[model samples]
Target: MGMAAVIYMILSFYISNKRLRYYYRFVSLLAAYGLIMSGTRGAMIVPLGGVAMFILLNKNTRYIVGGAICLLFIYVFFAQTHILDSNRQIHRMRTAFHPEKDASYLVRKANQKRLAEYMVHKPFGEGVGLAGMEGRRFSRRFTTDIPTDSHYVNIWVQFGIVGLCLHIAILLFVIGYSAYLIMFRIQNRELKGMLIAMNCGLWGIMLSAYGNNFFWQYPTGYIVYIFQTFLVLGKSYDKELAEQTKLEPI
Candidate 1:
């Protein structure tokens, strides 16, 4: 995924090895080009959301202000002006800003509404496998009737409002705790920066899961889990880095 490549680029910037860092940067550029050619709107959120998180984590007044200006420019570019509409890729991305007019988005929303009404009675959901098409092999009930376009929506359909709330709470806790550690517990500047980059990448993927089903899917799942694990275990990393630093000659 381009998000992975972007994370690599960000991490590479913090690498002390100049030649290796440059090599990674070159590879990241090629990977970014591939991402652009793919025309995936969700992938676009990686840079947008990741940059926002990066700014927030930095807590630097000047960088924060600059990031805000950049975000505003992006909003104007994608949501307001038609300057880049001539480009096919940009046109497809702009549609994400106007979900109200997008037929596919409307259908997904309609499906959520339908599921909401059906879920009024089934607080615990129909069953486990009944969320998406996985239930087709298990049961043919009301839960299986509608297509759950997003991972969150799919869980809501399968587990009902209660399970949905629990799922979200766990996710919030993981993200919250990891962020706190990164802000205060980590000591190695290089390791901290790399971890921050990974956190931003994972954050973007988590946010995008609202409109996608890749949270638990292949490739992306491994990246997400590994990043979150590293973030949560940041204190352990800090301890090791501290020891390693102690052994180095001044």
Candidate 2:
């Protein structure tokens, strides 16, 4: 929700009406507060990833430099120092930066290795609903007992390398196509910003999905679908905006 609000806040700036724009920004900020309180490590990536992508897509050099500095400071605070360790939320978020030292991460890694060995001969995976807890419930013929903590891992174990690779290829294509459209095709500045913001949010969510199944879950799934719809509609939006601009009274 916070991630979605942050995207809305970014788009709200392009809104023409002063009152509506301010209301959107103010409400988004209020909603963004939930991001901190939730303490879900993966959720932290949404904004950070969005900012990074924004820097790349946006041509504003000054803002890019400023964003870079902020990102650097965040990295130092989260990965290098324990300055905010006293704060429970901050401490939990920091763990995401130090995967080697995180016990749960290590466990997940070990489980992945075990799964890899077990599924080495099965290139197409043991089959759907047959690799994790669901697999155990269905059958033990080739079930993996370790918990499927990450969606990627779950996909890999169930679909095998072939399936995983195909899935990733599709994601890469979507990201690449959207980026190309944003950079070269989209002409409306506001539309460009909105599209880039969505791209960034998705990039973050895709990466974070490795930690949890954000793609199939509530809100994120809907958000992803909606974003894709807009992404493919970029040309139409640009044309509409161009028409609207021409028709506006000078």
Candidate 3:
């Protein structure tokens, strides 16, 4: 999956003028579909979030109307009809907001509370391995017997609030910097479209990380890091463009 994404990005760079726009859109849709099939509700957010960002940034009226219709159809088919199991969809929606009331939510809450209590005096955190070991040792501390694996909670427990804050700052910086580049520096439609998709993908994954700890773990983590690297690259591209524009005679 990661390799496919990289290939898609490289292709985006070399695509011809006529086909370039379609290529990025196709890749974005494919990525979104893959995330949805992953069956982790959190993972599904990536594509939808990316599409949302695309629509907002582009502001093309026809695309906006089309997106609205598609969203309506999705809500009807997935949320209204029982084809996708109305009850499960309802539960997922409810869990999105009041995760604390849901079983998994309660377990995470309990683990976080316990971890926070444990970290008060030890500001640097209990060290990385210690928290994982403690999760197993205090398996009984949570409502569920399963081990805690939430990235939000895990990072806090392992790095304390200080490390967590630094992590958050980096994310904020990426997001802000990406937006700045897209808005100000990128004028090429193909590159702009790719960056927009990347930005949305990052946002979706980051939002999903609130529930799962995929940000620094396997496949998803690696994908997110690569996407971030692309954002930085986009910024560099913008700088080059600015320099070129300056050299052109007005």
Tell me each candidate's TM-score.
0.91, 0.89, 0.70
Q: What order do candidates take by lDDT, descending?
A: 1, 2, 3
lDDT of each: 0.80, 0.79, 0.63
lDDT of 1 at 144: 77
lDDT of 2 by residue, 9-29 (tens): 667756677897888788777
What are the candidates' C-alpha RMSDs?
2.0, 2.2, 5.5
Q: Sort the candidates on TM-score, descending order.
A: 1, 2, 3
- Lowest-sum lDDT 10-residue window in model 3: 138-147
- Better by lDDT, candidate 3 or 1: 1
* Number of the top-ranking candidate, with TM-score as the measure: 1
Better of 1 and 2 by TM-score: 1
Compute the lDDT for candidate 2: 0.79
The CA lDDT at 200 in model 1 is 82
lDDT, candidate 1, at 250: 97
